[model samples]
Target: MYTLSLEVVNKCNLNCSYCYLGEKKNTSMSIDTAKKAIEIAVHEVQKQYDKTLVIYFIGGEPLIAFNVIYEIVAYTKSRCMEMNLKYMFSITTNGTLLTKKIIDFFIKDKFEIKLSLDGSQEVHDLNRKDYQNVGSFLTIINKLKLLRKYEKESDKKVSYAHVVTKNNYQHFEKNFQFLIDLGAERVETGIDYYCTWNNDEMKGLGIQIVNVFALYKNQVQIEKKRIYWNLLEHYLEMYLTTCNFYACKAGLNSMFVAVNGKIYTCIELPEFQIGSIMEGLNIQRIREIAYVEDKLSESCINCKYKSICKTRGCQASNYEIHRNIYEPVEVKCRMTKVFLNLIENNFTSQQLENLKIREDR
Candidate 1:
C-alpha cells in the first residue's frame, strides 16, 4: 500500500484543456490487459500490504503506450523479483515523446520523469495547447532544452512542472527564473486548478507570485525545491497532513490503474468511480459512492484546511470540473496567503541560513 497506479494508456498526444480524459479518450490496456493488471495489482498488494511497492505510470500520455510501457516495466520487474518484492517506478510524462530511444528507456529502467513544463513559451503555449491550435510549447521547450543538452543518464534526474495560470501569473518570477536557467534540477510550481484563482486573473497571479519572492530575496535558490508547495509543505511541516482516506487506507495507500482496466483513487480521483483490474481489484466492489464517504465538501466542511485537507480534490478533477463530488475547487487556496506573505518577508537571517543549508542537503 505504498502506492500503485498504472493507467497504461488513455491515449493522449496533446489537447490540454484541463483534460479529464476527455478530448477523445481512445483508451487502451491490452497487453493481455496489462499483464492482468499487474497480476491484480501485485495480488492486491501482496494480500493487504507488507511494503516496498511503488508503481506510478499514469496517463493520457504515459508515453502513449510505449510498448505497453515496456511490457509493464519488464513484467513488474520480473514479478517483483519473484515475490521478495520491492519495485519503484514513476512517470507523469508530457515531455513530448522523449527520445534517444525514450532516453534510453528512461536510463536503463529507472524512471522518475515528471516533466509537464507549464511556464514560458508564452506561458507554456497558453495552457499546453494543440487540437490543431498547435503549441506544445515549442515542442516541450525543445524537449527540455534537449534534456539539458543530452544528459546521457548520469544517474538520471529531470523534473519540471509549471501550472499556476491566469496567463502565467504575470510571468511567475520570470517563469521560475526561466526554469532555473533551463537546467531544472527540480521545479514544480502549480496552482492552476482549471482556472479561477479568486480571479481578477488570480489576484494578478497572486501579486506576481508575491513579487517574485520579494524580488528574488537573496538571489533565489531553494535548492531544487518546488513540490508546488505540497499543501503548503504539509502546513509547514507536520502541523498536520495525512491521507489514504484518513487512514481507512484508501484502497491501501494509493491506487489509480486506469486506461480501460479501470481502477482509481488518485489520478486526481478519476471521476470517483473505482474498481476494475478487469473486475477484482475490489475496494469492496467500487461502484463509486464518491470513494465511499471519504467525501468532503461544504467547501470542505467549512475549511480551515479541513482538519488538514484531503477528501477529494482531483478524482480526474472531480468529474471534469464540478460535475459534483461536492465542489471543493482548488487554486492552492488562492496562493496560500500570497505565498506565505512572501515567505514571511523574505526569510532572512542569511536567508534562514541558506534555507537550512539547502534543507540539509
Candidate 2:
C-alpha cells in the first residue's frame, strides 16, 4: 500500500498558531499539475507489489480548493478504472468550510474524512482560531453535529484529529471524552512537535498519555464502549503482530507532492525537495534521505527497544532539530518508550487476551 498526497492549496482561511506551514501563499495545484501527479503516482511509477493507493488531499485547509480536489479525484478514478488497482480518498480539513454540498461529495466518494477539532471549545479556540483571532470551535461543532447525524443515518465513518498542545495537555481524558461524546468513533492525536516542550511539559504530557490509555482500557474492558484510540491500538498491534510499524515513513512507499509539483518525502520538510513531477523522483536523494548506511545509528541497533525504535522517527524532524536525519529526537524517544511501558506495565494477561480477541473479530 502506498499513499499519494496532494497539497491542493498552500492557503487556508484560519491562522492557526501552531501551523507547520507558517506562511500562507496564494499557490494552488492547477488541473494540469494534479493530473501529472496522478499519472506519476499510478503509471510512471511501478507498483507490482501493491494494489491500493490512498489519494489524499491536504492543505492549509483543503476545502479552500475543493474544485481541485473534485477534479483530481474524478481524473484519478477514470485513469485507474482499468488498472489492477483500487483507490481510496481521504482528506484532512479544518471543518470550517464544510457545506452540505461538500459533505455530500465526501459521502458519494466514501472519503475517509478527518476533521480537525481539538477537543473542547476552549482548548480548540485557544490556538485554532481564524485570521481575525476568533475561535473556530463554535462554527465547527455545528458541522460536526451534522456529520454525526449523517453517519447515524448511514454507513459513513467520520474520524476526528486533535492536536495536544501546551494549551490542552492536562485535559487528555476530558478531550478524548469530548470527542467521543460528539460521536467520534475513531480519534487520533498529534503533539505540537515544533513547540517548546520543557521537562515539566514533557512530564505532564507523559502522564496525560498514560491516563488516556487507562481510560481507553476502562472504556473497552469495563464500560463496553466501542471506540478507537490510535496510540493504544498501535501498541496492541505491535505486541500482537510481527512488530511492523514505522515511526515515520517519509520517503518509502509514500510521497508528498506540493502545489508547485515539487516532491518531498514529507510535507514537514519542504526544504528537502527530492524531486519534481517534471523530473520524476530523485532515487539517490531519496536513498540519502533514508540514510546511506541503510542504518540510523549503531546505538539504535544495540538499544533494548530496537523493535519499537527501529523506524522510530521522521528524518525531517531529525534534520530540523539536530541537523541530521539519522539522529532521533530525545524527547520524542522518551515519549515512545513511555508509551510502550504504559501498555507493557499496565495491560493484564486477561486484558491482552481480550485485545487479541477484539483484533480477531
Candidate 3:
C-alpha cells in the first residue's frame, strides 16, 4: 500500500555471493514493458491508495538500465502532476555502477538511493565482487566520497545501507563509523537474507552478527539518528503508533514486481510469480496471496519469545521441497529476549505490577 517496487532490469554487472538472482539469466525490460508497469502503478495509486505513493526501482542492477529509469521517473512525475497525486522515488543498488551522473541525478531530483555495502573493505570484497574477481571496495568508496562531496556542495543528505554478514560482522562499529565520517546523513543495517548457507550456517552467521552488534553497541558513540536492527526499529516505530504487529507480512501490504512484470508477495518469493502487470495489476491477486493461510511449521511457534524475534521462517523455506519451518534462529531470539529483559528490569515495581495485573485481568 505504501510503495510499488518494480524491476526494470535483471542484468547485474557484479556477481554478489548472496544475491537472490544467483546465476539467473540476465534480462532487461523493454520500454514498452516499462510503460505497462508505469501505467498500472500510476492507475493503482490514483484509484486505490490515498497515501503518498513511492515507486521503488528494484533490479538485478537498476542502474544498468539508467535511461529507462530516467524515462519512467520523468513520465511518472508528469502524470502525477497532472492528476494531482503525491509521489516519490526510491532505489536499492550495488555501488559498483553509481557514477557521478547517477549521484547528480539523485541529488538534483531528491530521489532516495539505498546503496548496498557490507561492513568493511575486506568483508565487502569477499562477497561483493565483479566477474573479473576485482574487489569493488575502492570503486564504491570513491562513489560514496563523491556523494559526500555533493552533500557539502548542495547540503542534501544521502542514505546508505549496510548488509551484515559473518565476514564483516566483527567490524560493525568500525564500518558504521566509516560511513559516518563519509558524511552520510542516514544509515540502515540488516542481516543478509539471501545467504547460501543452510540452516546451521545461517544460525552461526546470525550469532556472529549479534556478537558484532553487541560489540558495536558497547563500543560506538552513536549520537545521531541511525538505524540499527532496521527490522526491529521499523516494527517498533509502527507498533508505537498503531498496536499492530506481525511475525511475517509475506503477502500483506508489501508487493514486489519483477522485471518480467511477474508480481510476488515478497522479494524472497521472486520465483513464485503470483501475478503479472500484463493482467491489469490486480490488487485482489496480491490480497489473495497475502491472505492465503499457509500452515505454520516453525518449531518455536509456541515459544513466548517468538513475538519479539527478528529472524524467523523465510520465504525460501516456504517454497522449499521439504518446507522446513524452524523457530526464530537462536541468536535473534535470544538477543530479543535479552533486550526485552533489560527493559523490564528497568521498569518501576509499581509499573511492572500494573502490567502484570492488566495481563491477569
Candidate 4:
C-alpha cells in the first residue's frame, strides 16, 4: 500500500491551540499543482508495483480547498482507472465546514472520513476555537448530527480522531463516553505528544486507559460486541502478533505533498523535505528516511521490552522533542512500559496464547 497525503490548503478558519502548523499562511493548492502531484504519486506507485494507492486529503482545513479537492479526485479516479491501478480516497477534516453537498459527495465516492473532535463540548472548547476565539464545539456537533443522519442512509461510516491533552487526561472515560453518546462507534484518540504532562496527569491517563481496556475486554471478549477503540485495538494486536517492528509507514510507502508542491516523509515534519512535485523525489533523502530505524538510541536497543514493544515512537515527535529522530521521547517510553505491564497483568498466559494462535493463522 502507498499513501499520498495532499495538503490541500495552508489556511484554516480555526486557531486550534495545539495545532502543529503554528502560524497560518494564506495559501491554497492550485489545480495545476494538484494535477502534477497526482501524476507524480501515481507514477511512483506504478514504479514500485504497489497493489493499493490511497489518496489522503489533509490540510489546515481541506474543506477550505473543496474546489481543488473536487478536481483532483475526479482527475485521479480517471488516471488510476486508465492505468488499471486500484485506489482509495480519504479525508481528515475539522468537521466545522461539512455541508450537505460535501457529505453527499463523500458518501457517493465512498471516501473514508475522519473528523477531529475532542469529546465533550467543554473539553473541545478548551482548545479548538474559531479564528475569532469562539468555541467550535456547537458548530461541529451540529455538523456531525447532519453527517450521522446521512451516514445512516449510506454505506459510509464516519470515524472520530480525538486529541487527548493534559486538560482532558483526567476525564478520559467521560470524554470517551461523550463521543459514544454522539453516535461514534469507531474512535481514534492519542495523547498530544507535544504537550508537557505532569506526574499526576500521567497517572490519571494510565488509570483511564486501564479502565477503557477493562471495558473493551468485557464488551469484546465477554459480550462479543463489535466496537473500535484505536489504542486498545493496537495493544491487542501487538499482544496477538508478537510483531517486532512498530515503525510508521511514513517514508517507506507513504509521503506528504504540501500545497506549494514540496514533499516530505510525513506531513508533520515539514523541515525534512524529500523533494518536490516539480523536481521529483530525492532518492538519497528518501533512502535516509526509510532507514531511520537503524539509527536507534542505545537505550532503546538495550530496553527489556524492545522486542515485544509495538511503540517504535513517531519520528516527527522525536525530532520535535529531542532534535533527533533516533532519540526516543522519555515520556512515551515510560508510557509504553506501563501499557505493556498492564497488558501482562490483565490477561492470562492461556488467553494470550489462544490470541496468538488465532492471529497467527
Candidate 5:
C-alpha cells in the first residue's frame, strides 16, 4: 500500500488548540503543484508495483481548496484508469464548510470523509473555535446531519476523527455516545500528546477507556451492533498478538506532502523533511530514518510487557514529549500501560476458566 497525503491548503476557518498546523499561512496548493504531485505519486506507485494507492487530502481544512481537490480527483481518476491501477480518495476536514454540492461531489467520487468532531457541543466548542471566538458546534452538527442524509443514499460511510484532550477526557464516554447518536458509525480518537496530563487526568482517562470498552463489548455481545472504536480496536488487536516495534509507516511506504511540495516522513514531524516533490524523494534518507532500530529505551527493552506493548507509540508524540524520536515519553507510556492493565484485569478467573475449558473440549 502507498499513501500520498496532500496538504491541499494551509489555511483554516477554525482554530483548534492542538492542531499540528500551528498557524494559518493563507496558502493553498496551486493546480500545477497538485498535478505534479499526482503525476509523481502515480509514477512511484507504478514503479514500486504497489497494490493500492491512497490519495489523502489533508490540511488546515481540505475543503477550503475544493477546486484544487476537484481537479486532482478528476485527473487522478483518469490517470489511474489509463494505468489500470487501484486507487482511492479520502479527506479530513473540520466539517464547517460542507455543502450539498460538496457532498454530492464526494458521493460521486466515493471519497472517504472524516469529520474532525471532538464530542458533544460543549466539549467540542471548548477547544475548537473560529477566528471570531465562536463555537462551531452547531454549524458542524448541521453539516453532519446533511452528511448522514446523503450517506444513507450512498455506500460510503462518514466517520468522525476525534482528538482526546485533558479538557474532554472526563467526558469521553458521553462525547462518544453523542457522536453515535449523531449517526456516526465509526468514531476514532487519539490522545492529544501536546497537552500535559497530570496523574489524576491519566487515571481518569484509563477509567474512561475501560468503561467505554466494557460498553463496546456489551454492545457487540448483547445488542449485536457493530461499533468501531478506533483506539480500543487498535490496542485490542495488539493485545491479542505479538507487538511489532516499528509499527508506524512513516518514511517507509507513506509520505506527507505539504502545500509547498515539501515532503516529510510523517506529517506531524515536519522538522525531518526527506525531500520535495519537485526535487524527488530522497530514497537514502527515507531508508535511514525508516530502518533505524532501537527506538525503545533500555528500560523498555527489559520490560515484562515488551512483547505485547506498542513501545514505539507515535513518533510525532515521542518527539513532542522528549524532543527526540528515539526516547519514549514516560507519561504516554505509563498511560498505555494503565489501559493495557485495565484490559487484563477485566477478564475474570471464571471467564478465563471457561475459555480454557472450551479450548480443551
Candidate 6:
C-alpha cells in the first residue's frame, strides 16, 4: 500500500483550469535526485518489511519528462531485483502525448496507465483545455484509441482519473457512461477541491453520486460488468469493514517527491514539507501527518456521523482551503453525510444485505 509519487517535471503542456499545483515551474527532476529518491524510498519500504514498492510518476504531466521516468525505471528495477522486492510503475497522463514508442515502452514495462480525462468532449473541454484554450477531448480520445489498440495486445487495462468540478458535476453521469462505453476498466473520480463549492452545488453533487451509483448498481447486477469505480468501492468497503477509512493515506502510506527533491505527503500541499531526498523523511512530521485526523476540530470529532463518515476530506485539500489539515472542509463533510443519507434512502435494506452477501462471495 506504500506509494512513492515523483513529480517528474513542474511543467505541463496544458493549462487546465482546476490544476491543484496552482503554478507550474519549468524545473525537472535531475537523474541524480531521482536516483537518491529511489534509494530512500526502497529503504523505507524494506525497513517496514513490505515486499512491494509502487514508484508512481506524477507531475505537471509526467510524459513531458518521460526520459527521467525511463532512467528511473531502469535504476529501480536493478535496485528492486537486488533487494528481492516487487516493483510497480504507474503514470497519470493527460493523454495528449501518446506515441507508438511511448505506448510500446508502457506495454513492455507493464505500466499501470491512468489517463487524466474528465469524460465527454463537451464536458471535458469545459476545464481541461490546452494552453491555447482549445478543448483536448479530441486529442485525448484519439490517443486513447491508440492505447486501447495496444491494450488488446496485452492484459494491461487502462483506467481513468476523472475530475469533478462544480461546473461539470451535473454532467458526471453522462461523462462516466461515456468512459465506460470507451472501454475504461476502472475510473477513479475525485472532486476538484481546488475550486470552491456552494451548498447547492455540493448537494447537487451528492445527488449526482446517488444517481450514478444507481446506474453502477445496475451495471453490477444486471450486466455483471467488472468495471471498477472508486466511490462505489469506498462505499462497499465502508459497509463491509465498518471502518471509517480516511480519503487519503499520504503521510501514513504514501509520499510525494516534488521536482525540487523535497518530500511532502501529497502533491497539493507544497508547504507541508516533511523532509527532502538529501535529508530523508522527518519521522516526527510523518507521524503527525499519519495521525492528523485524530487531531481534527472538536465539532468534527463529535459529529453525529464521525464514526461512519467516509469523507474526512484530504489533508492536502483541507490545507489548501483552510490552511490547516485538522480543520475539516465543510462541503466535504456535508457531502459525505448527504451522499450516504441519499444512498440509504435509495437502497432497500434487503438490497444492502444482498450486496454484502454478494461482495463476500
Please name the candidate that would achieve the greatest TM-score relative to the true structure. 4
lDDT of each: 0.65, 0.79, 0.63, 0.80, 0.79, 0.81
When sorted by lDDT, best at the front, the candidate numbers are: 6, 4, 5, 2, 1, 3
Off by over 4 Å in 1: 1-37, 40-75, 79-107, 115-150, 154-157, 163-168, 171-173, 180-182, 185-191, 194-196, 202-262, 265-271, 276-315, 318-321, 324-361
In model 2, what is the error at residue 193, expressed in angstroms?
1.1
| lDDT leader | 6
User: Can you rank all candidates by TM-score, best first?
Assistant: 4, 6, 5, 2, 3, 1
lDDT of 6 by residue, 118-177 (tens): 988889899999888898988887786678866876587888888999889999888888
Can you give the TM-score per candidate against the true fold?
0.31, 0.90, 0.78, 0.91, 0.90, 0.90
Instruction: Kindly list the per-residue Cα lDDT of model 1 for residues 6-69, writing each as its tens digit.
Output: 7777778888876656656677767887777777767766764564667888778888788888
Better of 1 and 3 by lDDT: 1
Off by over 4 Å in 3: 47-50, 152-156, 196-232, 238-254, 268-272, 282-284, 294-298, 307-361
* Residue-pair clashes, model 2: 0
- lDDT (tens digit, per residue) of candidate 3 on 168-215: 655666676666566554667765533444556555555554554454
lDDT by residue for model 5 (181-259), tens: 7777788887787778888888888888777777777776898777777776566555665566556757667778889
How does residue 307 of candidate 4 score in lDDT?
A: 68
Candidate 4 at 98: error in angstroms? 1.1
Model 4: clashing residue pairs?
A: none
Residue 153 lDDT, candidate 2, scale 0-100: 50
What is candidate 5's TM-score against the reference? 0.90
Candidate 3 has an lDDT of 0.63
Q: At residue 99, what lDDT does model 2 achieve?
A: 90
Model 6 TM-score (2 dp): 0.90
Clash pairs detected, candidate 1? 268-314, 268-315, 268-316, 269-315, 270-315, 270-316
Pitting candidate 2 against candidate 6, the one with the higher lDDT is 6
